[model samples]
Target: MWWSKSKVSSISSPLPCLCLLWLIVPACEAQQQDLGALLTAKCNSWNTKTTLSFPGDGSFANVTERWTVFAPPMYSAAISPATEEDVVKTVKLAAKYNISFLATGAGHGYGTTLGKLQNGLDIDLSQFKSISVNQSAGTVTVGGGVRMRDVIDAVFKAGFEIQTGSCSCPGFVGATIGAGVGRWSGIFGLIIDALVSVRLVTADGRIVQVSKTSNPDLFWAIRGAGANFGIITSATYRLHKIVAGANGGGQVMNADILVPANMSAAYFNALQSFSGKMPANLAAVSIVRYDADAGAAGILANWDYMGSEADGRRAMAPILALNPPVVSISTVPWNKLFATAGFGIDPVLCENNVIRDLYSANVRNLSASTMQAAFNKMGTFYSDHPEARGSVLELETFPNQAATSVPDGETAYPWRDALGNMIFLFSWDASTNSATSTAATKLGRQLRDDFVKTSGYPDLSVYVSYAHGDEKIEQIYGRNKLPRLAALKKSWDPRNVFAYNNALPTKYP
Candidate 1:
């Protein structure tokens, strides 16, 4: 039985509440034991591997730690399945018990959807790591558990290249399923666009293959809103020959510039101008944040050019003319770009247990005045709340030719026309006062609203990957696409078992 709010409200004193919780502990333990026994028995019958971890088990404890520790989901138990068959069994058993379950890849997602899983099962997919490349077909097949770094290294060794996320730690499948945006997106396209096919376990426990020719609707839905459908066991993606650069190597020029707060207006103007005519080989990111050590706010701009140093310099000439302080500019091989892009720190080693609130906006056209106002508000927020000094506003205006080239109706991803993705990331130590975190979250939302208002954007179209869980379904997957997605959800997952991660409703609003 679930604990209802009314039952908790009857306990007037703290002492009674503690006693009540202790009294209910044994019942919860029994439930966990029964669940574990059911999973074990089902796995044995299915002839699959399963490691059932009860609540408080070290494995269970570790599985709950997400990228952001704000409000992680609670699971009665966790299971690590070794093969696709094991995944099928796990899903089937969960459906039999009428239990909701979530498939965790890298645990890098930050949405609040994970927090809603109460007494649910965690289908950990880390054991499914596999990588295979077919040079003749110019394609690569990777397991669901593979990370960006894993695929990148494997493909690089095979004399091919594929688009991947900047952060090498995120699960490759998780990123691509949401229309993965990466450094090479401008030249090649989103990781999803290169998808040849996917081997997934549907909600009904069937191992199915989805592609353009086979199960086309499922294929289109998985390209953008995959997490809502089922668990992907493996996926095949197209790869390209390595580009030629200096000395017969694939070299990319990377530039990092720091702009003073006073130059925010000028910097944005320059960025707007550069983004409007962005070259296919170039990807740019701009960040506005408070540097506590410097006791002032500033802007950082990073440019990635997939070409020789001379071509990169020529492309960046307009922005360079603005004369911001150059932090660094170097040409390195394709694989080393992740390190230079500031993703050098491993996700596990970085600071954990923090409150994070993220919001996104698609910028079709940049308004300098609107951006300047947002920056000024950020300055005020940083000044007033030192605890949130680490917060940042990121504007990514990469060359999205390959992404935009695809017709809007072809996939569930609706932000193809957007030239820039604006992310307002606010964070603070979880140990900080709750009020501080609350204030920071409010400020982030306010900033996003102000940006939309100032920029004259018609609607609130947020990137589903970066959403904070408060956005409407239509906003994430455009208004026109929601009805179809809802219909698909009703057909594929009638019971709504995969109702995590900004879930789509079976019935459209």
Candidate 2:
């Protein structure tokens, strides 16, 4: 049995922001502090409920609870760690108590693997938000908790940039640690490719620095298996100068109405043709949506060119020729262009909305039909329930620059050399649509299964960060990387103190 306790004083103090550093301790001691007392004593705020209960708070809460969450808490315990020392203490406490813990940045993970902890300490690093640019070294050190927008703003201020997600709220460390991909792939590369180093607190509560030179094995693992290995405190990324006056077409193409009679075949053919001869300077993503108001279907095609406006026009000719788009293209600065890409989804809410399906390079062609069909079915599903906001199917193609540039064993992210990446995502308010929600989730998995069954696809290679809770350890860590990841886990986290996010098997037991 547990009881709650609270200490109140006449004078109130503001909460601390950004606690850094961490340490570990023996388990027995941590459990001695009455669970209820510990929570009531330290937790300034608390919300005890499922993700379905979170919407009422506008999606923000901070409560001390164990880690198994079927849904995100509408409220987030606002923790701002100002120093590395704070992180160390948190880790030590969690380890000593044998309590699961997870660190979150702008918490935009759509995957349940990130948000669903039954009972554990949630470390919100939002306060550690800071971005510094080193012009001479062409590097940027971003706080682990800093959001993509914060990074962009800082780098743009310093006259340089690196690839980042189109969404603004995702933290740099979490995204890159999870192999972040962005619109500038043709020129730059996936965010993981540019990563130089990371300051991490291992499961054992040891604060260590990892990079190509130090802890190479752990470094490789963190790049892809971020949460599985440790909590990254910050990341250093190699940056490059993005030429100014550079812009591309950011437009929405209505697929259902804009196309001529029965142009699905033509559309596919054109997509294949242009996609086959993808220009290095051009990057595009096609999103299908079901418009309830118009009672028709459509597509939102976002195109990007890293060089000049004129070049963007030339590069976009193939797509523009297909059909007159509803939202015509417009060019803007590379920074402003990315900002317009809509990266700023709220951290807490969107993090709970994550669900991703990964396909290997070999499966790209054979799975197109299954993928398209799934989108069509999902469109119908959403059409029936207007409240379930439209889903986003983003097909991102990686350039040879970063993924290919890095050697296979350089980092743990196995898909570095892959031709492209695709994500099938659908998010809804958990408070409502209980029946349809289950169906939509099942549909999402079915789509993945159908495509994976098709011949010519790469074997099970799921991104650890994007993994579903039901996925096996082998699925999250590819067959080959498993052994190495195991060794790393044993070496750094033998006790399995950090077994929360996409946990790696420490031993047979």
Residue lDDT tens for model 2, 36-97: 23333333233332111111133235322212234543222223455676677667756755
| Residue 60 displacement in candidate 1 (angstroms) | 2.5
Show model 1 residue runs off by greater than 4 Å: 1-33, 42-49, 245-249, 343-353, 454-457
- TM per prediction: 0.89, 0.80
lDDT of 1 by residue, 201-250 (tens): 99999998999998999999988899999999999999988855532256
Shift in Å, residue 345, candidate 2: 9.0
The reply for model 2, stretches above 4 Å from the true place, is: 1-33, 39-70, 73-79, 243-265, 342-363, 366-368, 429-433, 453-456, 507-509
Go through the candidates in order and give each one's C-alpha lDDT: 0.77, 0.58
- Candidate 1, residue 452: the lDDT equals 72
Model 2 lDDT on a 0 to 1 scale: 0.58
How many clashes show up per model?
0, 50
